[model samples]
Target: MTKSRIRAAKPDTQPHFDYFYDKPGSLPGTLNIGVDAQPPVIVLIDYNEADATRQTLATPEECLPYLDTESVSWVDVQGLGSEDILQRLGQVFNLHPLVLEDIVNVPQRPKVEDDYEDHLVMIARMVIPKESGGFHSEQVSFILGKHYLLTVQEEPEHDCFEQVRQRIRYNKGSVRKLGADYLAYTLIDSIIDGFFPVLEAYGEQMEDLEDEVITKPTRQTLNKIYRVRRELLNLRRAIWPQRDAIAMLIRDDNDSLISDRVQVYLRDCYDHAVQILDMVETYRELTSGLMDVYLSAVSNKMNEIMKLLTVVSSIFIPLTFIAGVYGMNFNTEKSPWNMPELNWYWGYPLCLAAMAATAAGLIYFFWRRGWFENFSDVQDRTSRKRG
Candidate 1:
């Protein structure tokens, strides 16, 4: 099997799980935007059955005229750069204070809320794969009303809504003819489908790790396995709740916020979410198994090393004993028994031959027991396989 090597990432460099929150005992609808947050960019796309118009509005007030129209209006606000702009957006759309807060303070759990009679708030997470490896997650909040859909994304850089926008702009699908609710469903579907490519990358990474763990596990392999596991865990946390949110969108339609047609589409999106979750869970299990395999491989390698050492020691035992006995001072001048061998002309040569014979016999014995065969043949076989 081909060996797979992954560069291990430091623990400190791992993605953080910290979420934003309001201060304890603070006001109910306080907006706490990140200091590093980019400034908000507001783009409006208004369309009806007859025609569609796309415009880059300078202010949130320009969206008011389109929102109250009969056509479906999509107000895409990318970034939470300024609190004043977001607050004005909330006023322009008549958004609930709590709704605006949720949109601003991101990293919220994926959920759907119907606190207002005229609007439904849905929070979803979108994961974008990094060029090097791994993924970055951001929150995308949706506010669906009678004739308008407002989407607030944490950052303006990466999103899965481009295809949805193309469909709206080109009138590729039934999106142009649908209401705001259908538009909301389309964006949500895009978000769900975005997970596939990221999950596929992880799947391939896991396969590589599986081979590396079993064949030639190293400290770096252990670290890579742990990193993959941690990433999978983060993926699970992001998708599990999103799945429930989609299911809730399909199951609970008390306010009739989602049309029957859109509900059917949401069901498909929900299935995709479930599939992504299943893949993540399976990869997680495989990574966990890889960790166990790594441990066994290390242990087996150590065992082989020790076995070779023992064989060498066994062969030298008798040779060392013979040399020691010959070197001992036995008073050969006074004792006849000890003096007989000491006086022999061939005694030194015979002792050397005996020691050599003892070592050769033990080596043959070990070879016959297949001890030497294992280490000698193992490397050859591995090389042949690689070739």
Candidate 2:
């Protein structure tokens, strides 16, 4: 009947859960890019101690000359629009078939592989919050070589690597003097830092939900709690393996591709990942608690409503019995005990007065027992606080 009641009665839409996976019994090295994937854009940044250069290259072959030089070349390929271009880029960089497959795939578990003699393969998921709400996750694959580092992203619209690019462009913080391994660490660190903003957004959302659940929980509050829990679960899934990957890069030195100095930086990155995971887990637990609170709040509200109905029914039971007895078809003239009062003029007025007195007495009893005090004022206070 009212806007608030209508809103509270509406059902929540179900959430969608999705993940990327290959078909059963399919090939091990299969590339399955999404149909909506954006076209590729290649950008090269080559630098030495003395100078730095950034360019948008037309072809993957153009990166070959810079790769062979003594300068550190960063070939950043954004988006996976064309299979042909991706394959050609792989060929130009001498990427292993399996490595290329991993790069082209839209979603892959975060991991690091040092099996290749000349290069290191690292797969990481990067997440950024959307303008509306929630977050967007994209898989970023890295191929680290002696003189160059190849980075591939699933989409071109969003990335957190712009700050790292700025650092390299300006030769700030000894980035130009460092090796490509250090460059990889810088980018990884940037990726790890990006998680903080998304986590902060969820933290604020959870706080608001906490207040809502305690004060004025509705079906929408329950839905919001579940949604926060689910998103935090996704965040945990993305960060856990990434932490292990960075730890592996630090502990395992079989390939000797990562320098000792860069490993120190990676250890810091690993700490950041662990911190992110801890926050995610904590928030998830809080959301679970919020769900419990929501259920309890709903039950309490229902109990209050039922109690009020019970009191009203109890007050009317005796009055209804009196009315039923007076309405019975008794022969007033046949027996004096049957209805002598029915012939009296004051009988009707007396009966009405008696019913009124009974109702007033019962109401006074309930009021004295504090039943009525708990009904209206407490609910009004709660509603005002919620508003």
**What lDDT score is found at residue 21 in candidate 1?**
64
Off by over 4 Å in 1: 1-16, 330-387
The deviation in Å at residue 328 for candidate 1 is 3.4
What lDDT would each prediction earn against the true structure?
0.85, 0.84
Give lDDT tens digits, candidate 2, residues 1-387: 100111222233212333355565767666666577888999999999899989999888898898778899999999998888888898898888788877876566799998888889999989888877788888899999988999999876889999888988787897899888998999899889989999999999988998999889988898788778877887888899999999989975733778888888888999999999999999988988888889999999999999899889987988788879688757778998886887889988998888889879988998998877866788999999999
| Span of 10 residues, lowest total lDDT, candidate 2 | 1-10
Give the Cα RMSD of candidate 2. Answer: 8.6
C-alpha lDDT of residue 14 in model 1: 39
- Please report how far candidate 1 places residue 345 from its true position, in Å: 15
Clashing pairs in 1: 39-81
